[model samples]
Each structure stands twice: as structure tokens, then as C-alpha cells.
Target: MTPRRAPAERQRDPERTKAKILEAAKAEFGAKGYAAARVSDIADRAGVNKQLISYYFGGKEGLYNELTASGYRNNSAITDPATPLAEVLRQFVFVGPSDRDAARLFVWENLEDSDVGFDAQREFMQRQVEYMRARQAAGDFPDDLDPGFLLLALISTASAPFAFARVARAATGLDPTSPEFTEAYAEQMTRLVKQLAK
Candidate 1:
């Protein structure tokens, strides 16, 4: 096995160290929530000194903020103007394993009644509503439908299978998180959204 790099060498690459810390923070916060997650635990998970987290991110709040911001940015891909809303619905329905942590973080926030990222999240949702309105104006959605309600329904549907995996499995007798199930669900959602547009 190759020898591990020294701490000084690891500290030399700030970007890599910050990335490791952020990744570790995501896991920790997902597993324990912001209030319960400890900075020392994140540092330990990242294999770095606890002080490094403070040095790089100022503290747990800053780390959480960065993760929340990054999550929103990453999810914005579904809002690409060129992609049809049906295809967008399909993409949102297929939440792969890599996205589980972010989903879990959302649940944790809800459970704790935390509003740490409320402003940003609300802004993001408003943008989705605006996107739906634009789609409606473009004739993709019927004028009769309320764009805000449609967005709310779409978000609920997209997040349901992941948020209630055990319920989904019990109801459908299939692993909701499995690729087969998600693919079929995604296709079904895509078809359903297409119908809404017609």
C-alpha cells in the first residue's frame, strides 16, 4: 500500500480539503441534521483536523450553507429552458443514490422544523413556478391550470417515492429506490406530464 500523505501536504491543497469537508458535512448532516451534527465528526469523517473545518468554513453553519447552495445549483439542471417539462419531470423522478443524502437533508430539516435554508429554497421554488408559468404561456401547459399548484404537485410527486420508500415498496411490492422502479416511474411521470401539456 502507498504511504499516506502528511497532514501538511494535505493542507497544501485547500480546494481538495474543502471538498472533502463539504462531502463529509453532507453525510453527517444528512444522518444527524444540522443541530445534531458535530463539526468534529465531520472533520473526523474527512480525515482532517477539526480546526481545518473552522479555518475553511468558519463553522458548521457556513458548511451547511455551502452544501445547501451547491444542492440548489446542481438541481437547477432540470430547469434548462431547452428541456421539455415532461423530460424535466422524468429527470426529477429518477433520484439516483448519489442524491439520497440531499434528500435526507431535506427530511431532516423538515423534521427539525428548521428554516436554515428557507429563503434560498423558497426562491428556488418560486423560480420553478415562474418556469411553469412561462411554459404555460408558451402553450405547453393549458391556461386553465394554476402554475403554482402544478409545480407543487410535480414536486410532491417527484419526491414522494424517495421520501417514502418503504411505503412505496409495501404498496407496489418493488424497491422504489432501485433503478428498474425509478426508470419505469420516470417514464410514467414523463407520459403523465405530456398528457397535462396536451
Candidate 2:
């Protein structure tokens, strides 16, 4: 086995350094929440100079926004009329629960500060609502359903398990964060969407 490299040494490459810092920031913000998270803690977790985060991201808010943007980009895709609603929801369930840390960060955003990525996320969800509206017009979904609420329900369904993974695990004795659980849950999520859209 290759010997483990020191944290500072691990960040030698600039791109690697930036990625490391983002990851560390995600974990820190996930665990401690936005109001309580500290830059020093992030820097220590990343194993880089505290100044490097400022140099790369401008400041904590910058890093947080970047994480929010990239997290949404990484998890969900923009859907069109050709995209199957069930499939889109399946992918969301698949990606959303797998990243427990991101779910935690989302909890922080919702409970502590809802302004973290409001504009961009609203724009993205608006597009989804329009797509859903088209589908409803075409009779693929219920005509009575509000498009925005449909999107919210799907998103919340996927996020709920992970946002409270620890609590669920404690209460149910099953690891909701596990790969097996996510795969099963994704199937259920897709099935539920299919039933709802019928």
C-alpha cells in the first residue's frame, strides 16, 4: 500500500487543492451548519493554508455558493418533454440519498438560511414546473396537480431520508444511507411517481 500523504502535501495540485477544500467545506458545513461552521475548521480539514481558501473561493460565502451550485448540478439534470418523469425522479432519488453529507448541508440551508441559493434554485425549479405543466397538458400527469408542488414533493421525497438519516437509522435499525437501501428506495420513488402521474 502506498503510504498516506500528509494533508498539506495532498493539496499540491491546484485543482486537487480546490476540490479538497470544497469537500472539506462540505463536510464541515454539513456537520456544524452554516452559522456555526468555521473557516479555520475547514482549512484544518483540508490540510491547506487558511489563506488558500480565500485565494481560491474569495471567502466562505463564495465557497458555500459554489458548493450549492455544483451540488445541484451534480445531483439533478434539467428535464425536457422527452424525459420520462419517473426516470428523472429515479435519478434524483439515486443521487440525493447517496450523498448523506449534502443532505445535511441542505438541512442547514433550509433551517438556518433559505437564501443560500434561492435565485438559481428557483429558476431551475421553474423550468421543471413548466416541463411538468406540458406533461399535464399532454395527459401524462394529473391536470389538477400544481406543477410546483409536484416538483417539491419529488424533491422532498428523495431528500427526507438523507436529511434525517441518523434519526431514521436510530429509529428503524436500518441504514438508510447504504447502497442497498438507496437502490431499493429509488425504485420505490420511481414507482410512486408513476402512480402519481397516472
lDDT of 1 at 125: 82
The 10-residue segment with the lowest total lDDT in model 2: 72-81
What digit string (tens of lDDT, one per residue) describes model 1 on residues 13-36?
A: 889889999889988998999999
lDDT of 2 by residue, 1-198 (tens): 989988987556989889999999999999988879899999999998989989999888888888887886664454667777888777777665567678788877877855766665676677778878877776667877888888788778878677777876786577887777778778887788788655
The clash count for each model shown is 0, 0
Minimum summed lDDT over a 10-residue window in model 1 is located at 92-101
Runs off by more than 4 Å, candidate 1: 1-11
Can you tell me which runs of candidate 2 are displaced by over 4 Å?
1-12, 78-80, 166-173
Residue pairs that clash (backbone atoms under 3 angstroms), model 2: none
